[model samples]
Target: MNGFTRTVMRTVLQAIPTILGIIVISFLLLYLMPGDAVDAIAGMSGSASQETMDALRDTYGLNDSFIVQFFRYLGGVLTLNFGTSISYSAPVLDVIMERLPSTMILMLTAFVIALTVGIMVGWAMAVFAGKWPDRLLTSTSLLLYSAPNFWVGLMIIVIFSARLQWFPSGGAETIGAALTGWGWFLDRLKHLVLPSCALAAFFVAIYARLTRAAMLEVLRQDYIRTAAAKGLHPMLIQFRHGLRNALIPVTTVAGMHLGNMLGGAVVVETVFNWPGIGRLTMSAIAARDTQVLLGILLLTSVVVIIVNVIIDWLTTLLDPRIRS
Candidate 1:
């Protein structure tokens, strides 16, 4: 087949073993935890009898050997069955799918904000390296990078949300607003603003720093000097030549962060009370719902793999050297 299709196919093939390993590890880790789904169900019910608890354990095959349980779960997973969630009393896959959209929107918004703003800020920082502007922005990035995620969300809620009343404090929508068309879009965008910013804060700092460094390095290359000697406009040289190549490294780093971005969502979702996989994950953890938890982890791994595959494809398209 063609090169692009082959590359993507190769990536998918390589990811199969990795996904399997993740599945096995995730299952074992959850299995080793103090309690199982049965315990969570029992505790939530307040007074489940020992007999009932034993029956649950038996029904779920919890009493089986670790090897037996693993194979059973693996068999189900291979067939696209994620079992059932003890906490929600629903199929794990179904529950995850219901919440996936909210999480995807939040993360995508955060990623866009982080990447776009960061590249611009970093370009500026590189252009004025060692100057006051660079110093000020550098300090700002450090502060933002150092801030705890939850605290960032809270402060934003306190200031922009609680004090200024500029945006909705939490949730994915205005609830009973019954908004439609552009009206619905704007309302959802408002609710998305604060949490996205909070989630993006640290990543913005990271991308900004990486881009700044990559820009500096790219600007020093012989091609950049050649372009400048050709009397190209300063902005054209800075962006078209410099930032274009500089983005190669930034893209690489961003690909690696795809998985982590999902993890970061847990805090942001919890803070804003946003309905998403991250929030569902927290709920699953609290209830020790291994089935739902496994489902989320598997879905997250799949998403990360898919995104990284796309990133890898983009990297080749961006850098001719890699393509060759």
Candidate 2:
């Protein structure tokens, strides 16, 4: 089979066990909770008779035994029915879908910024090898990686947003606002600036260090020395041979970080008040919105599984040895 087909088949095989495991875990935890969905809903509503609550439970099939509820949840999931949110009074899938686009946009932009800048800075450090630039870059990366994300976010807010008045302090956009042409685009970008920086800074640091190390190691290889001795231009040697080999390690790190960036955007999202899944999930948990919580958990697990599969495919492309 071709590479694409082989990859899809392999991912499907791997996904079976992962999906089952997620289902089992989600089912067991939610099932073991003290109250049924009806109880949660009634508690929010202030008061309801026992008969009314029991009837509601029966309507939602919460009256079923633990094993029966598990089967029902599994069956619903198979049909792509994530069920209604007890708190939101809306379908769990709808709520998630509504917030997904914003989260993806924020994460995609952050990832792009992190990867591009990190690689470029890292490449320069590698080229310089033992020079001041290398040491400076390494030190800067270590500092950023070790710094607390919330603190960095607060600093950015204070200096840039509050003091300088250069950017929005919080929220995706002003309430009841319409964007006209490029003005809207620019406004949205203004909102993204702080949060994206807060999210990408730490990742950029690690990426630069990793890329520098990988590139330096590749530079020391015999083939690299042979390329240099052949009188090939320095740029050609670095770009064609050294960079490609260095990228094998970068790709692995990038793939791992990509999945993390998607799920780990919570801090940035919360700080900036962006209307994304992270904020939504956090609120759900605090409010005891079990359906929303469950939906978010399942969605995160699925993304992780898909990312791992994609990383496996990328590994083959980066280092053809994986093809064997």
Candidate 3:
């Protein structure tokens, strides 16, 4: 097989173990969590009879053996049929899909901003190694990295939203806002700014420090000296040679962060009251909506696996040493 094909095959093979592990682990954990759907709904609904609870249990297939119920859930997922949410009385997939777009937009925006700003800042710090710029970048990155995300989020809310009244305090858009044209697009962006900044703050710090450290290490190598001796334009030499080598580690960090961005959307989304998957998941959990929780967990596991596979492939491409 060719390089690309081999890499694809390897990724697929690796995914099998990951998928099976997640299925088994998630099933066991869910089963172990106290209270079945009937008990949960009964407690919440109140004044429920034993017969009604029994009927509800049968309807959810919770009456089946643990192993049987697990396989049934797994089968439904594989068939793209996640059954229905006990709490919402809607198809599980429908509930998840309804809130997916908002999360995806937030994560993608944060990832792009974090990477672009991070790499540039890191490169600048490396260029001015051991100087005032390097020290400043290092100190700032450490401080930001140590700061709490919720705290940062609230500060953004207080400063930008409350004090200046420059941005919306919460929600994806104004309650009755219409999604028609450029006006809606601009408004949506305006709402996205605070949450995106809160999410990207720590990431920017982490990536900047990581990239700077990697670049510093690469710059000490013989090839960097050789490139300098060749009299290549300083900009070209640093970008083409220094940055390329430095990217191997930075790429790994960025890719992992991308996967985390999807999961971590909950914090930013909740704080901003954005209608994203994280908020959806939180509601499902609060309502004891098993189907929605299971579906979301499975989907998130698959995404994280895909991200790692992509990272591995990129590693081989970036560093020929890993290709064979």
Candidate 2, 36-145: lDDT as tens digits = 65766677789999999888778767778978877877788889898888667899999999998888888878888888888888999999978998889888888889
Best by TM-score: 1
User: Model 3: residues >4 Å from true position, as ranges?
Assistant: 320-324
Residue-by-residue lDDT tens digits, candidate 3, 134-177: 99998988887998777889999999999999999999888786
Candidate lDDT (C-alpha), each: 0.91, 0.83, 0.85
lDDT of 2: 0.83
What lDDT tens digits, residue by residue, belong to model 1 across residues 1-324? 866788889989999999999998998998899988888788878889999999989987889999998999999998999898877878988999999999999999999999998888999999999999999999999999999899999999999988999998999898788989999999999999999999999999999999999999999999989998999999999989999999999998998998888989999999999999889989989898889889999999999989888888888888988877
Candidate 2: which stretches are off by over 4 Å?
Answer: 33-63, 321-324
RMSD (Cα, Å) for all candidates, in order, is 1.0, 2.4, 1.9
**Which candidate would rank higher by TM-score, 2 or 3?**
3
Compare candidates 1 and 3 on lDDT and give the better one. Answer: 1
Q: Comparing 2 and 3 by lDDT, which wins?
A: 3
Which candidate number would show the highest lDDT if scored against the true structure? 1
**Candidate 2 colliding pairs:** none
Misplaced by over 4 Å in model 1 are none
Clashing pairs in 1: none
